[model samples]
Target chain A: MTLLERDPKSPLTWSGNLPVTSRYTFGLAGEKFFRAIKDEGKIIGSYCKKCDHTYVPASQFCEKCLAEVSDWVDVGTIGELHTFTVLYEGYDGARLVQPEIVAFISLGDGGLIHRLGEINLDEIYFGMPLEAVFLPEGQRQGSILDIRYFKPAG
Target chain B: MTMRKVAVIGAGMTKFVRRAQETPKELSWLATRMALESCELTLDDIEAVCMGTAPDSFDGIHMKGEYLSDGAGAWRKPYMRSYVGGGTGVFVPIQGWYHVASGMFDVVLVVAEEKMSNFYPHAQAAFLTIFDHTTERPLGPNLLWIFALEMNRYMTTYGISKEDIARVSVQHKRNAANHPCALLGDPDITVEDVLNSEVLAYPVQRYDVSPVSDGAVAIVLAAEHVAKRLTDKPVWVEGVGWNLDTAHWTNRDLVYPRYVEYAARMAYDMAGIKEPKKEIHIAEPYDPFDYKALHHLEGLQLAERGQAPQLYIDGTAARDGNMPVCPSGGLLGVGNPIAAAGLMKIAELFWQLRGEAGDRQVPGQPRRGIAQAWGDLMQVGTVVIMGR
Candidate 1:
């Protein structure tokens, strides 16, 4: 039956009019990017001389300064926690049995905001220091999940 | 030094909801019909059409302007679409101002709509895409994170508290209680209640943010000559201004909207409004989030920064207050349908100035009012000042 012919009161729904798109990634390039962090325990950033801005989660262009970033900077593993929240409600398809703390951590030059791992909620505070922990090389996916969140600074 | 006047002769809208069962085209058609009917004009009477939607991705329809032509009654008509995220709703009307001010079209129809529910699983994830796609999105930050960061800075720098900011939400939503189309109006709530609400980010709670709604709104503008002939009491669009800021949102301080201030100053200069706080009777300063109302209040120079929340506590920003803000319940209560929400603010100002707002009318006679919308990662400011 045609979409309009179906009963409007029925619970069944379709995405006929709505549009959808998927993402694509290169095999070797994606692998190398992920494997570096997993095996070497290093953090990567892209630097642009035209804009003079460094970005985490690395990028090809300096959006504001509008210059291409050809140089890579090694971000120090330790940083300070600017602010954080322990989310009680499930979000974006991930349901956690226990709530998770997503934090905004400030590096020396810039900062990276990400989820925290293996940390007690009560132990966290504003301005607290933390460090990144890379995933084991064998289990690396070459994606953002490389560091798997940061840990408390000693 | 010069004057350019435009008038809104037509209006249209769609039934607002949490999720639209109709397609994007159908939604546009619904609002377009209502706006045309209000103006006592048919689609044929419209000289041109200007469309506004928050983001191409929110509706999951890229190049949505072309797809929505049939519903907006733009078939074979000059059509254009522009967006400024949350600011698109108000920007649509500003675009209409140009259409008439430049003498390009005598009658221009402005339409704004959004169907946020289409981004299923999580609309907040849609916000993840709004950040630096590669730099910020990988962090899995939600939309509220940016607001939270800004709110935190506002609070820390100005010494504002959660309760102080919460008062604006309480007052605005309470004012919305009388609004005809208010979606989340509640009078019984107190500042304590807002403070107690779940902390999504450090300072932004659920109540602090505008609800995700599915709806559409439209308004028709006519040049002075045609507008004077169409209606005996046409609200004059005395001035309009829109400006965009750098996308480097992180570099700037979010305590106040600098771009909004620049845009408002430009409009006020054109409208000959030397004193907005005293001359303007009514206002709708984009309240997509409750704190935003206060932020924009300061940005528009309605009140001094860090003083807006105190104004709310003093009942000065209420419906019958000295200078009422968001009398139509705003996005918090009235429902935010993206682009449509800003147009709705313009319509509300139109109704108030014409003395046509039945139930949501302010206490005394109001001569002039201003409506402003901010969007595009808080980069764009669209301001319109209207007078009777």
Candidate 2:
């Protein structure tokens, strides 16, 4: 027999909802990474000597060499802008008074995603030099926003 | 020990829309019912059922596969859900092929559904949680950011201009005019129109992306012998392959999707296709983002590395071209309901090979077609090959 052979009648609709909520804590690796930024204005990365690679988020193991990596190295404060976008909307689906600039910053060894600051929209381009702008120590928190945003470096 | 053969006998789908009054279960039921009816079969005919859907976050339900089982026509019989983010649409059919090919089931039903409208505060916002919580989320990353970054890197690496990339949106949206299920079809769209559209992110504009949509799709698969009895013409599943890249997406170069290439190779090897560019008649690579279609085209071995963007400029990928692509309007032109969109590709291949694709049929009557879906943190790639 052929399919959908009959002009099928539409079925009745049902509307319902199941509210769900949850929370999780950052693990050890995250704890240490965040502590370093909060305690001291230092950015560290996991150095994998086996494959000669560095990860900005400080991974527990090297993805390439597959070796346990505890070697922490300083991943400088400055980076290069690989790419950027101007967003007119916020995360909550609300329009922002001013455009937001989101960028992928390429450190020498790894890449970090963050917002850009203090740069003219027209001046932004691929390969533009950038440096992390950390908030004052008194106001620092163990979060990515502690570094505030990345801005064009002289 | 030789493996049994499997064939697709029928396909069904609900109209793609931004919002549907029906619930997820109802959507699945409609599609499944149509597939069964088209194949002239009843629930008793299906030996097993497989459900394919994207993240549970969109549905705002945990254990999405389990929830969708009943409506997918998997109430009591063997049931399973195949999920790999956006690739689940095509992957579900591939998984169903296994049921018949393994001699475990004579007939299998495959269904994919996504109700993006179900999420509160807009569907786009739910994607925010896909970012890394410890390192990346602090940066307030959104879905468009990754696509923009990849698009920038690809353009810079290949020396491809935004105008060249925009051509894909222009061509695909124009082609969508013939697709009844397409959400944003426009025959008069132009390259300039894409460039001038609002920039959600640089290089990715309004037209360069697929709309967030609600849709469901289903296909009935039967063993070779059973297919012969059910339908005069059957689309055989010649080959299927899927691969995943490392989750450390930032650590590697995004210029090329190596995972997709590996996946295509696996499927091609199974299909015994050595020269894809010359052998395959049509293709439907995932196109959630416009550039991704070209990226996957290269991965599918349809064109040389860093060269797919030029195919559209030269009129090579048009529906009437020698190697037509996404004749069903693709996720870019049609609505993108994630998993449903991908399965829609396989459905397109089935209908196209049977010469049943009314207004969107490719000329010359194609014999072989390929469809692919990609998802999961720029990692997973799923491929399926079919022939009449």
Tell me, by DockQ, which candidate is best. 2
Chain B TM-score per candidate, please: 0.96, 0.98
Regions more than 4 Å wrong, model 1? A1-21, A24-75, A92-96, A108-110, A118-127, A136-142, B1-4, B20-22, B56-60, B131-133, B196-202, B246-249
lDDT of 2 by residue, B2-98 (tens): 7788999989998887778788888999999988888899998988998999988888788989998998999899999888988888889989988
Candidates' C-alpha lDDT: 0.77, 0.85
> Candidate 1, TM-score vs. the true structure?
0.85
TM-score, second chain, candidate 1: 0.96
Stretches of candidate 2 above 4 Å error? Answer: A1-21, A92-94
Cα lDDT tens digits, model 1, B20-135, are: 78877888888889888887988888899999887767788778888787888788989899878888888888887888888788998888888877776556667766775444
